[model samples]
Target: MKILVVDDDPMVLEVLKHSLAHSGYDDVTVAQSAVEASQIIAKANPAFECFLLDMSMPEIEGDDLCYWVRQLPQYASTPILMVTALANKRDIDRAFAAGASDYITKPIDMSDFGMRIQQIDRKNSQNAFKAPASISLLDKQDQEPDRIDFSKPVHLGEITGEVDLASLENYLLQLSRKGIEGLSAFAFTIADAAKFHFVCTTEEYLDILKSTGQIISDHLAASGFFLSYAGSGSFVGVGQNANLHHDEWEKTERSIQEALAKVAVPSSLGLPSKIQVFSGVPLRLNGKYAERSLDILYRTIVEAEDRCGDTSWAQV
Candidate 1:
């Protein structure tokens, strides 16, 4: 992938370029500042496919630069990875919130950096966001929308503080670094979402998910949570205050189902579709998570979700 890297440090830039070359990424262009990066991007022949931005810059910060790139028409969905040494949760959050696809810490680990780069490159190609003009169910269509892969997590374009799964992992990783106290994770699944996927077109299914995510976001917004659609009917969230309540989940679910009931399912064979949302118990992120892989945390979430009955609530 063609990469444009922006960093103020000269030696750091050389090291990054070397690392990219080690990973077989030869088409790299480096810039000393965000302004220089913009100049390079503006003058490039075949527009750069990916970006590596330094979170800490002299003039314009990487988070602001990321937002600037995201505002451009052609590069909306392009991969933009933040390169930073700081682990302050607020800074990291701002970077992701500003549109960073993912981040790699400074004094970068060659192995982990390579993997992160490859993953974002592959993911960017796989799940492209359309940034819907309206939340209303798919606009009237002459032909049916394409079939959707119910299990593949797509890029939820900034829907109520939504970030990609990779950024979510990084957020968790940063949380672990500073002791995971007062942190908890929760998940909710649309009980019969697969059935909806069968009845709705790809675009229509996405509409349902976006709407569901919006409600969940609004409900969890009070808890200060970052949400992501984990596909397969599951929407997962991480909250800093660790306030996960049974009544709140029920209320959120009811709100989602009530809203969905109004959306007419175009291909439902005239059968009124009913939507139900179920939540699993919240898992506390404590010492165990500090030493364990974030992947296992997600697995624990899946297990917790599996323990969920129609009305049963499980605990960590």
Candidate 2:
């Protein structure tokens, strides 16, 4: 549904955006600061079904944002999901006191993230959850078989200036330095391009992803990647998940758009928002030749650029 993801860290925002996108909720808006987030919310009234906010932010805190949101005449009952690194009871209690509907710790789990979102959706639902299938909120998309090559290193070719390339690089370096076991996910801040961008080998890194999903989600939310989008409102995603075919990948991307469509927002701004999914052939991830992986992603981005063809999200 129409949810606002507020975070200051660009990398975390990307991760959360990706996480939610993966979860099938596509209409996600991100705001780096609470002020910008408020502007979007006021503009899109009676929409923004939920808010995934970071507990800490510059100028405004997540708790304060929750309080402000609760005070909004149209959002008196809106759900606010707090993303926090601290699991202290007092901190959670403070969030609740400020009007948070739920709180997820720094490291968020995919299963837990799904369950929490489902719970929130159920609560917002008019009737009680009848059955698994009856809960239609979950978008219907075929799950792709996990196919990732992890025997070698990954590639990270030329980092785009639009993305937090440095942060990503540092994160990868830390992973290599401390070793994957000791280091956790990396966080970053950059201009809003999309929600998140990640590079990993599926077959070998599946457990790593699952194990770090929670932490990744948490860091993203806590940093502000989970905030609402204050940019043009259009998202361009390019990736090659070796496990998914071109058509299957398109379907998966469509599911995200469909999910975001469910959120009803004010059309006055005419924000032409759409999810464009592109795919290419699979490649090897030698880890050492990380450029190969980046090449796949870069090609996808280039394709998106050609298709975007002066069509801005603001016009939609």
Candidate 3:
């Protein structure tokens, strides 16, 4: 795949170029800064297929550059991995909020970097999602969208702080058990959303998803959190839990429910008048029985979904 690498550091740029070639991705382009990257993008013959951007720069920081790239229709759904510092929690969160697909830490590890690229390539082989040509009609007549893939994660566009599901998983995989010490993961799911999906128009269903995603980011707003909406009417996230008490998650759940209550979701399609949102216990990332980030990530998702024979119900 054609690739673009943006970093102000000359050595880092050369190292990344060599690494990509090692992984058999030789069609790589290099840019020293955001302005240079923009210039290259505007005049390219065949558009670059992927982007590797440093999260920090002297001016026009990486997050801002990511936002600029996402605004372009063609690259909206393309892979844009960030190169970040493991200790910079706030910057990592900003990158995700700005629509970065995934990130690799600085002081790059040569051995593992190739594995990350291979993972991305596998998905591309599966025909990763591409941006739609145009917006869907907003009228009530909007038919329900194509079958809701319970396992697939859809894009929530610019407003929702959405990170790709695979990207989120890759982030977790990159962390060591100790690296996850201060973080926790949670899931937010709409009760009986499948019923709503079948009855609501395409616009309404998407609106439900957009609203759920917005509420997750708005209510659970944190400087170190990143969220992903995995299908089945849910968003799963990992964030800094130092400031959030166990009880705080319950409150956030209630807040989300209260916020969702005001939307007046149309009931004509065999849907409930009011929808309820639920949160499973936040799984502490470094807790006992969670020896690996991937394992703990799924455990949190299961807890949020309350599908492991836990008691949970809609309050509305």
lDDT of 1 by residue, 184-298 (tens): 7777777656666766767777777877777778666245577877777778777776445767656665666677666655556732365566666566766335546465457
Name the best candidate (by lDDT). 3
Off by over 4 Å in 3: 84-87, 128-145, 158-160, 175-180, 221-223, 242-248, 287-291, 307-316
Q: Write the per-residue lDDT of candidate 2 for residues 193-292, one digit (tens) a residue.
A: 1221122223222322222222222222111111111112121112112323446535544443354344332232332332232222222222333344
- The local distance difference test score of model 2 is 0.47
Clashing pairs in 3: 143-202
Clashes, model 1: 0
Q: Backbone collision count in every prediction?
A: 0, 45, 1
Model 1 poorest 10 in a row by lDDT: 307-316
TM values, all candidates: 0.79, 0.40, 0.83
Q: Quick one: how many clashes does candidate 3 have? A: 1
Worst 10 residues of 3 by lDDT: 307-316
